[model samples]
Target: MPATPAQPSFALPVPVATTVAPPDLTDSTLLDVDPDAQMSLGAVALDSRSDVVYATVELPDGARRELRLDALRPTGDERLPLVVFLPGGAFLRCNKAMALEARRHVAESGFVVASVEYRVTPDGATFHDSVRDVRAALAYLRSYADDFGIDAGAVALWGESAGGHVAALTGVTDGLPEFSDAAVLQGQVRAVIDAYGSSELSAIADDFDEAARLHYRHRATQFSAYLGRPGAPFPEIPDAVRAADPAAYATASVPPFLFLHGSEDMLVSPSQTQHVHQALRAAGADSTRYVLKGANHGDVGFLGHPGTGLPWTSAAAMGVITGFLHRRLDATER
Candidate 1:
């Protein structure tokens, strides 16, 4: 196996002492890496964009399942930082194309990005099953690092909504054997970025407004559906639900977290992230929260509006994420 190149550390782009700031993120010191830098896995171009790879794992029932990961290989040297992204769909389904597009910015910024297609509830799966798959995905990526040119140790997780919940849960419970399948290594997630993820499954249903309840009256609520309990009230939260709550596992040893939630989010509620952030802080762990004003659940606005030239641009978010990864995963100091 090729030795993993030492990840470089740079000061976080945030200005600590500034009388006046640069006009845009372009002027920040963090913009050192040209986002358009060329880096690709050492294979003939699979397609126009990504290559799909399957990672197989054995379930507790002795059944085998294949988890799919769509890889966005980089264009630079071998052994780049790896980022595993899980998509949002209330844990019921995932839109592969949408998820890949959402994380495209990360991959384009000189990292090997893998969009995970973990088991979901509609397949008779539960949080436990999804978590095992998440672990398997990480282990599979690391085990095949040489083949894919990824740095095994410098890995991060990013997810949105339901995917965000799993990402946060996995981050907090990194080394716990319970979360890992026998065939998979315990997850060593070094950093986490959760966008509008639900941590406390029991309370998420209540976050729905009267209009939302009316709209989903015929369908099972997200919490109830995921828990496999129709008509279950918040007061009757099951032990399984509590066990799945990422906040329950928060500790100082967990990796640094960057949470982004829309202030106006009705579904899942911004408080879900706020609670997790509070728990992380209370545990003395590194945490950062960015609340988007006037943004709602799954809003593209959170990714930044290019036409408006806003301060909270996608360029800015990438800087924050890349900077955080450098600080947490890199060995050298700025």
Candidate 2:
């Protein structure tokens, strides 16, 4: 199908993410090149004359990666709040597009948002690499905040599914150089919104039935694709899975949280939200959890349908997310 407009479905442009070979090349057996250089992302960058556009940065690894945000102005005339967005695709599929459009949606409510592209398990990537890229995206956003119409110190984390897992971890465990390097994340994020993502893997619904066990085992493969050896023996699965969890960093210093999940979500159970909510509460971090009725893992929005076909916007959905942003970024007015 052709690309659909940004709404309802929330599908971002998947750029043919591959590296183009330089015109000048040696004739020795066609030359050896990195395969990540051949990854196709199908990323489309567009600007509606709103501050800035998408751009790529050469990481310390010399790989050209993508980051999207608006242009920041030096004048104190327009200091907009910002949110760092992480896209969902089981940590291997999606990119900055879904988060970019979502940012623009909330930006209409007055905030500058940034979309990040992290390393995934597509071909050559590791779990640590994903965390590293997220931290790098945070640092890069801060470095250019003045140029992107953003307030460097007032950024919230917004994400979905696996993306939410990272954002939640990033929000809660700021200042930890191990998972992330954003020193500003310590006290900056007033709130966070996680959409249908895993909050605690340990709380997965009653792992007794064979089907249930296999379902989780399959999900583990996604992480294994990046964090574990494809051919590794089964004995290493437990350690590998534990190492990738975001729950390990849950603490009182983490920011408040807003979790939205469908009661019927098959991928990640609603209990995951409950588990995280419980942790944050014990830690004394402000939190809210909303369970949508009759919804599934697809789109937690209460539009009565999963995609663009839904007639109207879900007020609960928009209200919860925006209210969180306003409270955190704009401080509730007394």
Q: Report the lDDT tens digits of candidate 2 across residue range 1-334.
A: 1122344343321111112112111110111222122211123232332323344545445677564443212224476677777777766665566644345556666666666666666535665666666666666666766666667767778878778877776677667666654453445565687876765443343313345544444444554565545544224566665665666667777777887765445556656666667778777777777765544554434333345211112444555677778877773431
Please estimate how well model 2 matches the true structure, expressed as its whole-model Cα lDDT. Answer: 0.56
Residue 239 of model 1 has an lDDT of 73
What tens digits encode model 1's per-residue C-alpha lDDT throughout 227-311?
6565565456567568888988989989889987655555566677877888998898988887655445553332233221122
TM values, all candidates: 0.74, 0.70
Q: Which candidate is the best by TM-score?
A: 1
Candidate 1 scores a C-alpha RMSD against the true structure in Å of 10.9
Model 2 TM-score relative to the real fold: 0.70
For all candidates, what are the clash counts?
7, 20
Which ranges of candidate 1 are over 4 A from the true structure? 1-51, 57-65, 205-220, 228-231, 300-313, 331-334
